[model samples]
Every structure is written in C-alpha cells, then in structure tokens.
Target: MSSVDIPRTYGALLIGALFASILSGAVAVQSLIYQKMYPRDPRSIKLLVFLIWSLDTFHTGLIWGSLWKHFITDYGFSAEIDHIPWTLALSIVFTAVLTFSVHCFFANRIYMLSKRSWILTIPIVLLAVLRLISAAGTTVEMMILQSFSNFRHEVRWLFTLGLALSSGVDILITVSLFYLLQSSRTEGGRFNGVIDSLILYTFETGSITSAATVVSMICWIVAPTNLIFMGLHFVISKLYANSLLVTLNTRKNLRNRNRSVSGSGSPNNNQALILEARRAQGQNSATDSAFHVKSTEV
Candidate 1:
C-alpha cells in the first residue's frame, strides 16, 4: 500500500516458510515411523497418513513458490507487494483441505469414543465442513481480486469466519475428548494411571492444535496488514499432521503398559482390563478381545 515494508512482507514470509519446511520434515519422519511401527493399521488409516503427508509436502512447496515469486521473480517492483501470487492463493485451499481432513478424523474418533453418538459429533463435523467452505471461498476471492488490500477490504470476513470456525472446532473437539476421557476413569481407580496418561495425551494434542489456530486468528485480526498471520497459518497444517501421528504412534506403548498391569488375571478381571484398555485407546467395542488393541482410525 503506502510502502513495501520488506521486513514485515518478505521477511515474515521467509521466516514462516522456513519453520513450515522444518515442521514438514518432522511430518515426514513421523509418517515413516508410523508406517513401520503399525503395519497392521487399517488400509483407510494408512491412506490417510499418506494423504496428509502428501498435502503437507505440497503445501510446503507452494509456500516456497510464493516466496520466490515475491522476492525473486518480482524483485524491486514495490508495487508487486500488493499482488497475491497464485501459489499463495492455492495454498489456502490445501491448508483448508488438510485441516478438514484432520478435523473429521478426530470427529470420527469422538464418535467412536462417545459410543456412536451423532448428536455430539454432528455439530463438529458441520462446523469443520463450513470452515473448509469458507477457506475455499476465501481462495476464490483472493484469486479474483489478486490484491492483498482489495481482498482485505472486500471479503476479509470470509477469511475471518474460516479462522473462527477452525478455532471453534478445535476447542470443541478438545473439550469433548477431555470430558469423555475424564469420565471413563475406572470406578476404583485401579487403572487410573493408564487413564490419566490417556487424558494427558488427549489434552496435550488438542491444546497444541487449538492454540495454534487461536494464535493465528488473533494475528489475522490484530495485524492483518502484515504477513504475520499468513506465516502462522503455514504451520497450522503441520501441527495437525504431527498431532495425529503422535496419537497413533503412542498407542502401542500405552496398550503394552495396560497389558503388563493386568497380566494373567482372572477371566472377569481380564475382561474388565480389556474394556479399560479399549476405552483408554479412545474406543468402545464390546467384542474386542483382551490382546486386541483397538485402532484409533475413524
């Protein structure tokens, strides 16, 4: 607008892209570990990991392209600072897609943990879907306007709505999971240790993603003139990817601990332990055997 603030415009972009790439590397490492550690996971789950990783990788590439366009291709052209590159515009769609996938994945987990309760899960899914739609609309408007100032002035509400929905969904998911896990603690606190571990894990994962979304939303609202918000937005998808992988990868250890705690018990005790174990894994299935570890995939 008034002047090309290289620090806030390009420098913020460079820093954000660097962090996003580093996190993408973490995603790749975690994805490979998940594949190696849990080969028995369902086909759909495997496919989901692959899809999220692919999207993350592609999103990283798009970010670099946008950076290149701004700093290299259009260097010294101060007026070009206002124009939104196609790569950046499209990255919004990918971010939305990644967020939507992760949200739905968790929603399905909540459904399973809540004993197939649609009443609790439906609102979350609908909010996530609306978030995705809002992102798509933002992307379309960005492309059509092709100018940061124009987009901000005309359709800023669309982007704002999308961010708000993302935060709402994240907070809702975290609270639902925390409440469910807290309520599932055994009557006598025999397996309180295991349930406590699960509750801690759920709270940590949800908090990480929700905090990132909330911070990004605040940046978007308070400093929309700069690229700081977009920088944080770049990392949100990576957080979601890593959170899911961490959740899946830790299941084996937790299941083993549950087994060790309840080893060689009487038939009734063994059955109770199995139910507790499944519940700790965020699942509820009456038919699950003692040794069978329930998959976290929706």
Candidate 2:
C-alpha cells in the first residue's frame, strides 16, 4: 500500500468543506433575495427554494461530520481512515438528490420554452434519473464495501457515469434554451438585447455546473487513490444549488425589463437607441470614406 500523505488526503477535504460553506452562504443570500424580489412566486417554487437551502445546510453538516470522524474521532488510529463514514455516505445521497432536483427544474423550463416538446425534455429527464440511480448505487456500494479502495475497484464506473450524465444533461439544457431564445429574437432588434442577456445567463449557468462535474470526474479517474476527487465532489451539489438560485432570482429583473418595455407603449427610448447606433455607424462610414479619399490622392 502506498503511504498516505495526511496533508494531501485530508487537506483536500478541508478545503472542499470550506468552499461548500462559502457557496452555502451564497445560496442563503440568493434565497432571501428571491423571496423579497418575488414574493408572489408560485408556492411550489417557494417550497423548492426552501428545500434546496435546507438540503444544502444539511449537506454542509455532513461534510463536517465526516471530517470530524477522520480528524478528531480517530485521532490516533490511521487504519480507520480507509473506512467510509456514514455521514459521508449520506452526503453522497444528498448531493444526488440536490443535483436531481436542479436538473428537473431546468428540464421543465426547457420543456416550456420549447413549446411543450416532450421529445426534447424526456431524454434530459431520463438521463437525470439515471444519474440519480447511479449515485444511489454508489452510496449503497460505499456502505457495503466500507472502504474507498474497494469502492473504487468495484464500482468506479458508476460514479463516472453519474458525472458524465450530469454534464451531458446540463449541456442539453443550455443548448435547448439558447436555441429557443435565439429563435425568439425580434428582427426589429428591440428585444435582441434581452434575448442576448438570456443566452449569456443560460451559457453561464450551464458552464459552472458542467465544469465542476467534469473536473470532479477527471480527479476521480486520474487520482483515485487520493481524496481530492471526493473533495471536488462535495462542491458539485453546492454549485448546482447556487446555479438554480441565481437563475430563479434573475428572472424578476429580466421580466421587469420586458414589462417596462411593453408598458411604456412608446418607441421613443428604442428609437433613441436606434438613432445612437446609426450615428456610430455613420461616423465609421465617414472615417472609411475619408481614408479611401486619402489613399486615392496618394
């Protein structure tokens, strides 16, 4: 057996717990902002927000508990480090649940935005469910095996598949939303800015979660002996939670902008914007014309 570097193995976990803690704070703040900004949001949505926050809080506690078991409880016994802690096993399940919830939420959005296209949303949902199942299987195996080395040898493929499915679902959702928003663009260029903003948000939200999943998968594959992969995995659920919260909170701002544009019933501001754009174009045209004149003279 390779000698375990306590700092590398355990320090990774400590750093991951710190990151999870910070992201959890962001989740709480975003949830508060969402409540204040959209008080009339559907009861279902409010409940979802509360549930995600609660799960995140509990997930943090579990990470800490696992840390305590490793560092404090088994202070003198290094052999116990190999065994999977109950808190850590449960944390994996919680992460799977959180990821599944967020995935479902985005899947529903894609369904609505795609005009109730079951064809598009069904595949994403299926993939998400499969990911959840994989995660559950991983937890069960972890408990039964009770050792990281054994779990890695027996069912590392399950964990890898879950991460791949998660990344795939996120990409699918982002592309679907981006395509829908792009197609909805106004030829008149009035709502193009709004559509562009939506596109950016879609890309950003998808990228964050996808990137984390991919990195975690890489760590698991490349360095199975270390806890770094497990550490990265700890942050994945937090990223998903914050991504959902940010997406939900920003809807109010986007909707209000759209409403203001509609309610004013006046094209003056739009016209001014158009005129300003034209002015810039005209200046560029004149500069080009002058350059050509000088070239001809020379």
How much lDDT does each candidate structure score? 0.80, 0.79
Q: Estimate the TM-score for candidate 2.
A: 0.86
Error (Å) of candidate 1 at residue 86 is: 0.7
Q: lDDT at 115 for candidate 1?
A: 76
Q: For candidate 2, lDDT tens digit of each residue in 1-298?
A: 2556667988999999999889988998998997887665556777889999999999999999999999999887877777799899989889999999999988877765665789989999999999999889888999999998888888889889989999999999888887877776645755567667778988998999999999999999998877898889889999999988887776656656655655554544433111010011333432100000010110
TM-score of 1: 0.89
Worst 10 residues of 2 by lDDT: 289-298
Steric overlap count per candidate? 0, 0
> What TM-score, computed on C-alpha atoms, does each candidate reach?
0.89, 0.86
Q: Which pairs of residues clash in candidate 2, taking residues 3 or more apart in a chain or in different chains?
A: none
User: Candidate 1's residue-wise lDDT over 213-248, tens digit each?
Assistant: 888888878887788888888888999889877777
Model 2 regions lying over 4 Å from their true place: 1-3, 263-298
After TM-score superposition, the amount by which residue 51's alpha carbon in candidate 2 deviates from its true location, in angstroms, is: 1.3
Q: Global lDDT for candidate 2?
A: 0.79
Query: Could you tell me how far off, in angstroms, the CA of residue 177 lies in candidate 2 after the best superposition?
Result: 0.9
